[model samples]
Target: MRLALVLGEVAQGLRRNLSMVVSVVLVTFISLTFVGTAILLQFQINQMKGYWYERSQVAVYLCTSFDGGPCEEQAATQSQIDAVENELSGATLAPYIEQVEFETREQAYQNVLEQWEGTAIAELASPEILPESFRVKLVDPNQAEIVIDQISGMPGVFEVKDARAFLEPIFTMINTLSLSAVGIAALMLIAAALLISTTIRLSAFSRRREISIMRLVGASNRFIETPFILEGVFAALIGSALAGVALIALTEFFVGGYLAGEITTIGFVGTSDALVVAPMLLGLGAVLAALSAAVAIRRYLKA
Candidate 1:
């Protein structure tokens, strides 16, 4: 009977400030959606690093006639090539090097041709413009810097490039985006909290007479406050449910449907990631609402 009465008071409180309750719900929905997206984006970023870091290699580019630095206007001689090859298989670098694939100037030019087949840039491309290189697959991708330091100062090498350097900018951008989502979510959560507080205060004020009568009849603080807290919880529950649905749609259509087709090279987040985040969002919203309501109720009673 007491549980039924508390639930009834909760429903009554929700009806008194319908617009404010709706405002709290919308704010919570938007906030939690941003929170969920930020979490999944971080998850995707971590997965991308794990998947791509293993494949990243270091390129040791041999000098060409057209190249600057170390070449002095002459192509790499056969002796320089031999020296580089010997150094690669030698005792010092042998531990770090997993496998080495050599690319000839002609092979490089054909690759450029196929890559820029129909472009105007292809017309100006020549074998002499591109440098032949050894693609070194390292035993550990993290050991790339060591290989670079050793190979960079070697004769006939124009540049030592780590492929992982290319991925840093992409990850940096994703991280920035994640931080931005978190910022937006923070602001919206504050709005939700304030709205929840305001809604509780209004409900309390409207029921002030009944509350005083209950007090006169020896009602406990828990009995008076339980219904008000439940009011916030119910609105938050609706908002959380909506946020969960939005996260599912985002994963299904945005990551799975679109990004999976367009960017095939990198693995994206899946529905399971969203499902994992849904419960977290629900709990977070509930906590925010409950705290806000408790503060409002305490302050209103004292006032």
Candidate 2:
């Protein structure tokens, strides 16, 4: 009987403030969608790091005739190459170095040709311009900096390059994008909270006379507040449901259909990831709405 009365009151408040309820729903939906998207993006970022870090190797480039610095415009001699190779096999670097593949200038030139076959770019490349470099595959990619530091000043070394140097910029951009989405979601959630508070205040005002009669009949504040709080929760829950649907669709169409086709090297957030994020969004929406409504109603009742 108590549940029925609260339900009726909740229904009445929703019906009376239908426009405001809809506004709250839409706002919550959009905000939570951004939240879910940010989470999925972070998950994708982690996946990319795991996938790329394993395959990434540190390239210890040897000096060519065109190189400056220690090379002084002279090509690396056989003695210099032997000195660098000695360091790789030595105790100082042996444990860190999994395997070293030496690429001669001729091999590098051929690789260029194979990459750009039938193109003028391939014809313009020459073995003289290419450096004979040692590709050091580390047992642990995290120790790349250590390897780079030790080999950087060695003879015949022009530059110690890591694949991370190329990939860090891309990761930074994606991380910035994820943070931006979180920022936008925060602002939109604030807007939704304010809308919910206003809706509760207006509902309380419209039914002030009935509330006074209920209080006179020995009604408790808890009984009066329950309906208002439930009203907000219902609206936010609907919004959360919509946000979940949008996330699933995005993962399916945008990730599975588009990104999977465009980028074959890395895996992406799938429907299961979306499913994991959906519950978080729903809980966040409900909690935010309930708190906003409770505070708004309590203040109005006191006034």
Candidate 3:
């Protein structure tokens, strides 16, 4: 049968170039793993942004002992606090602020105690030393700088800190890592493509006599090309399958088991995320291999 002969040719090509096939498989595996890591990191970042940013608040720390900005080495008075409250509620900055919660010194101190519970640090905290502050939630989290600028020089205010500022550096680091992974994946894929092209060319060269005889008998281009294309697809599929396994293990053991245990604050990608990415990796590998084989055959193994 035509299908059987094509499969036979594919098997022969693979057996003849087993080393190159294995190399293609390994390269595709590593490259796709990097690609999957980048995607999962992006997903994790989006999840964190949705969870943290929605609850993010701008903390306006009132002066306890005013050393510099809007403070005179004295505790903030009730009138100054009330003035801040009025400003926050009035028309000028009201459009930016969603709501505000005032925390008293005792409450702030209690929060510190709770945070430092059972630690030696708790003993150093005192309610009198803790500055009373206002927690301001913004209508748009991106508008945090606007709130910070408005409240920074105001009386009774020590400094305005946006909760998002604390998170930006961390997120920025994650994004950089994701981009790095993408860059690495791209380089590996290029290597895989070149390796595939070389393998197909070698296979075609080895079978040149057969190809010549078939061309003399008027064999169609599709019939001649199918075996080589299938060989590349077979090698790539193996690599892609290995990559999928590695991705699943990574998500399960590293992200789910290790990271989730260490940082219980945020949810991480799991096996399901790997499953979502696995099929895409397989498809990408197959497509890359097929295209590379076709190009190599057309250019170097022409009938």
lDDT of 3 by residue, 1-303 (tens): 999999999999999999999999999889988988888889889989888999899998888873555687777889989988888888988999999999999999899899899888789888888899999998998888887887788878888898988998999999999999999999999999999999999999999999999889999988999999999999999999999899999999988999999999788878998999999999999999999999999887544
RMSD score of candidate 2 (Å):
1.8
Better of 1 and 2 by TM-score: 1
Off by over 4 Å in 1: 114-120
Clash pairs for candidate 3? none
List model 1 lDDT by residue over 174-220, tens digit each: 99999999999999999899999999999999999999999999999
With candidate 3 superimposed using the best TM-score fit, by how many Å does residue 145's alpha carbon deviate from the native? Answer: 3.9
Best by lDDT: 2
- Every model's TM-score: 0.95, 0.94, 0.91
Clashes of 2: 0
Report lDDT (CA) for all predictions. Answer: 0.92, 0.94, 0.90
Tell how far residue 54 is off in model 3, in angstroms: 1.1
Which whole-number lDDT from 0 to 100 does residue 88 have in model 2? Answer: 86
- Using alpha carbons, what is the TM-score of model 3? 0.91
User: Model 2 segments beyond 4 Å from truth?
Assistant: 110-124
